[model samples]
Target chain A: MCELLAMSANVPTDIVFSFTGLAERGGVTGPHVDGWGISFYEGKGNRTFKDACPSSESHIAELIKSYPIKSEIVISHIRQANRGCVSLVNTHPFSRELWGRYWTYAHNGQLTGYLDKFKVSRFQPVGYTDSELAFCWILESVVKQFGEQEPDDLNAVFDYIAGLADEIRQLGVFNMLLSNGVDLMAYCTNNLCHITRRAPFGKATLIDTDVVIDFSKETTPNDVVTVIATRPLTNNENWVVLNPGEWKLFRKGELIRS
Target chain B: MCELLAMSANVPTDIVFSFTGLAERGGVTGPHVDGWGISFYEGKGNRTFKDACPSSESHIAELIKSYPIKSEIVISHIRQANRGCVSLVNTHPFSRELWGRYWTYAHNGQLTGYLDKFKVSRFQPVGYTDSELAFCWILESVVKQFGEQEPDDLNAVFDYIAGLADEIRQLGVFNMLLSNGVDLMAYCTNNLCHITRRAPFGKATLIDTDVVIDFSKETTPNDVVTVIATRPLTNNENWVVLNPGEWKLFRKGELIRS
Candidate 1:
């Protein structure tokens, strides 16, 4: 399995600091160094950087550390390559267009027999990877449900997604992160974790490597943030662990369930 | 609108490097400097750090640069006050639990007149942000569709989510990102961008800040990675731009649409 990370904040914040720590694992700390990618959301568009090398040794990863790209919502991944060939088109954090907005997605687990059930129209896989095929399958489902026109009911759309996830989970592990330009949704069939930060800041130390940061000094009395990941990155903070076959929704650093 | 940053790699990677340039915008490079947060995925959980202050001036942000935490996936956010006050409850990247797994979500656009229609039973908002309310509303819809039992079909799930998104978009901008532990789903009603990386490498540069990195030096001959963002992060790369009303699904760094 691979790992996942995400953040939701109230202000334009830089992720370079946190990214610096993760880069070490690309080739030094952990074994996820098959490939790496990052995406940053600007006003209406997004900025994305990716590499097929270990983030720890990748020059692109190093540059990302010094770049300081800010965003309100973000998603990232590191690959271990279980299903597809190690190619650029098979990297995590894939993108597509729907309903006049950009949709980004990434996965951390493998699914069996998915190809047997997955199908798409004119959309073809740029690379021969099960992950990309799954993404296209999802898009095809959306088009089938709403046709060319977009749906007008948010609830209906979510219900449809949940249904799709449930079906895929049956095939195998199906942990995932998904987003449009507006909101974020998460599902876990195997492993996942998350945490929310609000006022009364505290200190945190990384678990995978030696690193610590005091958030109290960097934050005001009023600020809220929420993060999601496949594993716990910090050693000090109490990360919330997710059970198999679970899912949640988040926005603006808070949890909202309808 | 707000901004989002994400990183994924085969090995553990840190976000600090890219965040440095982004921090400048919190109050310097851009206007999103209301608050910030970051999350890194480790083994089965996440390590997160957040602050309400502008990252440009925050000591915590600096400390992150020096830290060496590593993970496969990382998500970071910088806020721009839109709905809700600048308080802890009103940050981005909200998180929640359902069916045992942890879920993470975030939003970039506003949802006008959403408060009146969105409603939830077992789940309620801890904050007063429209984004949170939307999240809850989506969850509620899922529960209503599938009840407590998991759906039997994956395509059905995607159809439901896409339908819900279409419905919500009618209310206003509905771009968003969501994930569980298996896959990532992205929806675009307005703007979004994404890029993928694999074996053959290339060079790229940051658009918002002055920075450049080469992938050829860091990556192996076999590697694949993808990234999604609100806007293109690099000035030299040809990032795939999302059209209005488009959505895509990703699994294991590959695209899959039914």
Candidate 2:
């Protein structure tokens, strides 16, 4: 059990507003306070800031709040330890390199016996967590299926990941966010919601705190931003909660319906 | 081409004092302002802070100097780009996971046609830099030689890496620092120095900044700390410079003579 937050945008965008709401849950409003982490993808490179302390009190988290690191794809998580000990290695938003591209992953739900059932190759889990083990299993399967080259058909990759997600969902709750700087994936077994803000964006308010921002003032007409979280972050936005065992793929903030 | 700093200690130790000197070279004292990165190992996990911004003026660098994230093993670099563009991907201190352990590397010198000489397999470089390519090749070679299990004999691995370093040095300058949380390795082709501080510690002043710290007051008598850098960080301490083909291995802050 944890909390997940992710973003995909047509342009380089900062997730300070949504992060403020989700970070509040790390200790202030929710019980997930063991640790937290965030990854921001910029071009071929991405930056990750993780703290073993709760996000509500971590100095690095405070720096992340103050620093507006803009990126096109971002994935974040705040954990409440279920299986692994509280340490830096067990913190979420784990990353690996595949196809010469860095891929980031964060899970909000727990698996029952992933380490016992799953097999890992190429990508191995550095920490003792079922979430990381599942991620490693997924990547290992990807490498086995696709080799070092990314599939030419995006839909084929999407369907492949969808099948993987369905299989993982049978093990336990499998809500997670994954991205490789360009492609964003969301898989939900129990809890997850997403909202996309396009050209005629309006003001939004955080449900956790009394913070509001006018998107019109902050974004251009061409900017398209999509944010997904374990729960709805804003009070007024219409977030779409997926059905159980459902998965979706997005690129540059646009949903891939295929 | 750049400045490098590394530390290995018997106990968790912060490098704020040495980092202050090395960071100054990013823009204030020298011209390695293209990018900078530092990795601090905590148990099996490591935290890396990278910025394309100059370390002399980066807010993240300021946080690093202020917050004392103590660790037993650390590797840092400030880069002046030669083979890649001045971007976040081209930053030094590139890392990859091998045998479920995160291996960090930072190079201070340039290579001539490393892409032609080195053959990378199993591991791939996420960044377009000779340094990253070299790191990938080394890790690939390590995996190829030792398989998934680390060698029981440390000297054999050290000798293997030494041979790899010698081969790369034939291409060009190859001063670099490498670590896998348990062991720290240093190889010098041009500029590098090392100093070990233990009992009977004394005050040391920075050469790049007007800062002084009394190690006796800050450390226990039994503590052993080794600091390695492109140049001596302290003005008063005597540092041993390695020969062009010399390589040293350290474990738990003690030099491994075996």
Tens digit of per-residue lDDT, candidate 1, span A1-258: 667777766666666656766666677877888887776554334445666677887766776777676677777888888877665546677765455344677887888887779876423444556776777678768777876556677557766787888888898888888776456677888788888878788988876667677888877767777778887777777878777767777766676642
The lDDT for every candidate, in the order shown, is 0.68, 0.89
lDDT of 2 by residue, B92-144 (tens): 78878876888899998888967777776567787889889998888888778
lDDT of 2 by residue, A1-258 (tens): 899999999999999998999899999998889999999998999888999999998999888888899899999999999979999999989998876788899987778856666887567788998888888888888878887767677577667877898899988889978887778999998999999999798999999988999999999999999999999998898999988988888899999752
TM-score of chain B of each: 0.88, 0.97
Per-residue lDDT of A175 in model 2? 94
TM-score of 2: 0.98
Q: State the C-alpha RMSD over the true interface residues for candidate 2, after superposing those residues.
A: 1.4
In terms of lDDT, model 1 sits at: 0.68
Q: lDDT score of model 2?
A: 0.89
Off by over 4 Å in 2: none
For candidate 1, report its TM-score.
Answer: 0.52
Count of clashing residue pairs in every prediction: 219, 0
Give the number of the best model, judged by DockQ. Answer: 2
